[model samples]
Target: MEPPGNATAADKADAVETRHRAVLRKFIVRARRVEEHSLAADKERLLAWARGTVTLKFEPQSGNSTMTWDLPEEESLDSLAARCRPFLLQGDPVYHGKVTNALGFFLRLAPDELRNYLREIRESWRPLDPGDRETIGYESRTGSISQALGDLVTDKELAYAWLYGDLVHADDNGEERLHGHDIDARFQAGALLITNVAVKAISTLNLARAAQSQNYLTLEDSVFTERVVARPKREVRVEKFATAPVGTPPAEIEAALDGVVPRPDSSKD
Candidate 1:
């Protein structure tokens, strides 16, 4: 039969099904074996398997220290610290809680690094005692990172991290109480970019009149005109006529003026 056609279509399908079933059986068996092996293994082995695989070295420092990670060359330690500072100052309770918890996790993973950084921060910040409270009490009351930032940002306030600033006399015995710090602060208002257009309009007019009859009106017959006319036979008057050479409605003139003049926003002006 053509030597079984090398492998018939039906045979190929059967082979594929058999392989798939075999894989499923192997997976089932492996899972069971794993469960049994886990039960038989000692607590230490199981614990070791469950623990995180990555390892980071921690170098302790004296008094205060700086922990440098194997970071990219472009990144600076001060920049990293500054980035973390704002997160610690978030105002939302939820964000504050989450950041504090994450910091706790970092401490657990690298206690030496975290503690050293914290010590450095505390050393830089001044502590306050009840006896010295009067000196900077105003700052102590309202100088929070949140309040200071609010004054600058004009937006949502920031939360305070628990370990941000140091407390004085925290470990003192009876009568000596702990006092929080008053952080020295400065703020600058952002400049507003504004654009404005100014405009103005002006109009002018001239008029002339004429006298037609000397009997009705007189100009040259008057004593004031005697200097120019010299002598006049009789008191003469000449009729005067007047006509407007150019005229425009006051409202129309006002409307035209309005188009060229810039009106200020009364509220802001």
Candidate 2:
């Protein structure tokens, strides 16, 4: 990656500057993707599900009698984890590590400049119109971007613990770290913290866009395209099952099955 031996000092300087700009551009791209993923995630809905605000109802398919069961805490956590997996999982494009690393690069490139830019952007959003008093309250219900980033940095260990131990893979070390903790509380904290991280990512789009305007960076307009897509609607229904005596034949159970679709038979192929 070194410049040619005959290259002049000006050439070397230009090359290095180009490389640094490339880093900023890369960070901008990743930050944009994080925002896109966050939008699709629907932060409020995920938070509600993670916080157990939504009642989870399910019917057993194999039980001898028809009944509805409330989803257990473990299952609820699993559902929440699935929604969170794309944003926090290690290999995911929008993983917290990737987002943080990009922001770290921006910091490394120009520490004071980046801090100043963030402050300026946040303050710019501070002023509100006199007629907007109803919506603009004493403070934001969700913390500011700077606050979110600060919390994410301070609580990094907990973030990873939640990711590795509960939300994604069950690493032994992660589980050990989670030992002696209230499972639900830790999970709730982790989910909210993750949401904050997403907020940080989304907020930084504002910063990056502002930076581009100031000539601190550059980005394409297409990077900010609307990415959220509507999901197709589907119908949900409960299946009925009846109690049977012991030693019931498989044929009888198969005959009694209702609303059960048989899987494709692959053996013929």
Candidate 3:
């Protein structure tokens, strides 16, 4: 959970250049294998990409649908929190309250923020006069809520840290060396992502509410109007084999693929 050096200022005072160096070091280590090339240029190139930011964009779509995309460096915390408040309020009293507080705790928001937010929504609530038939079943509510949670935790990649509950670092060494404040710092960064997830969840909840406001539809019957879609992409940058190509095998093929340096027979068995 170490903080990103410079692109983001929310979590730490760590210099961006310094953080970039560390990230590059790790990136270089991973990118080193399966290729024989100088990394100075690649280091600079990838560092530039790492130094970039992540942003969230929202657009209105047809038929009550809203679309959201996370751009390179522009997420709106205000928009995120606005989305969370309404969605959390839709939940049943006990569990929903706890989830709200959990978000408050992790995101480091004011203690009463969740409570106050829910209260405000309630105060603002007015039952539709077209009403008596406007009701959604528990099964419909749960199903829709579950679907919304899935969207936040997966596909969108917004609540990754929260969903997985761990530090996500890619290393050839397969070791997580972060300790102490580094963990909290990264958690802070993740909290920012969580804010976006909360908003998306709220959007789904609104869709369900829309269906509920109508005569015959239950939550499950609600048309899904809001969606967060990530463009599918696949890139094959390198290809390396543990076994040498065809019949001309290199002696170091196994070692290179295993990433193991040869061990001398220093200790006799």
Candidate 4:
């Protein structure tokens, strides 16, 4: 039965979906659970959005702790850039939000990565520090990741496990070289977040819709929470299955075999 009010079940669904998409459209991050083949397209989309040729308008939703926005078709890139120019290249929360979403979408990064990503951003602010900047490069298609940071993009085991956790991939035995979400990209993604050209341009365009009134996007470490509350379901499942009975064929029973094979002498015997 439908609930009484202006809002019905279908209305709620539409509201939730609209909220979901409104949330997605505000960030430059790739969509969660995107198929590997579609990543190329996502990459292109991000590039185009960054380039500022895309048409969009800023429309903030009703909230403050988290600001939600909808993108509408309108205006030029110059107008978009004007809005973000103040926040550009600065350690802004809006900038951080984009990076967080990117890592969450691409790496499905561990809860700890939140700290690491923040540190990376703060570290990028110092122009004199040639350490990580030299070590990590732009257009670096291939290299090993710093355990201090992340692993190699070529690590299929890691990629497969992450993708599987997200339910995006199942088969682990892919002999072919798959396109990996590289550390450089992941690092560069959030890390560029001392807000360089790519980050400034892309993130501005992405969040242009909501940049006027913004706060941090909520991201929780659900995995860590699960680990803390997780119970021993496996043992209980095993016990239940073990007690399940299979019908015995009396004709085929080895009733005499126990005696013939020399069963242990019973105390009652």
RMSD of each: 40.9, 19.0, 23.5, 22.5
TM-score between candidate 2 and the true structure: 0.43
| lDDT score for residue 119 of model 2 | 55
Model 2 bad stretches (over 4 Å): 4-6, 37-115, 119-156, 173-177, 226-269
lDDT of 3 by residue, 187-239 (tens): 33334443333323342233224323542122223123322322367577666
For model 2 the local lDDT of residue 115 reads 68
Identify the runs in model 4 with alpha carbons over 4 angstroms from their true place: 1-43, 48-75, 89-111, 123-269
How does model 1 score by TM-score?
A: 0.17
lDDT of 1 by residue, 131-239 (tens): 1122111221233565532222110010111112211113322111112222111100000000000000000000000110312112233222223212437676855
The true-structure Cα RMSD of candidate 4 reads 22.5
- Report the lDDT of model 4 for residue 225: 23
Give the top-scoring candidate (lDDT). Answer: 2
Instruction: Find the candidate with the highest TM-score and give its number.
Output: 2
| CA RMSD (A), model 2 | 19.0
The TM-scores, one per candidate, come to 0.17, 0.43, 0.20, 0.19
Residue 239: error of model 2 in Å? 44
Per-model clash counts, in order, read 13, 0, 10, 0
In terms of lDDT, the poorest run of 10 residues in model 3 is 134-143
- lDDT per residue for candidate 4 within 45-160, as digits (tens), equals 43443332323444467332432222212232222223333333234433434443433443233345443554454454332122223322223234346433233333223222
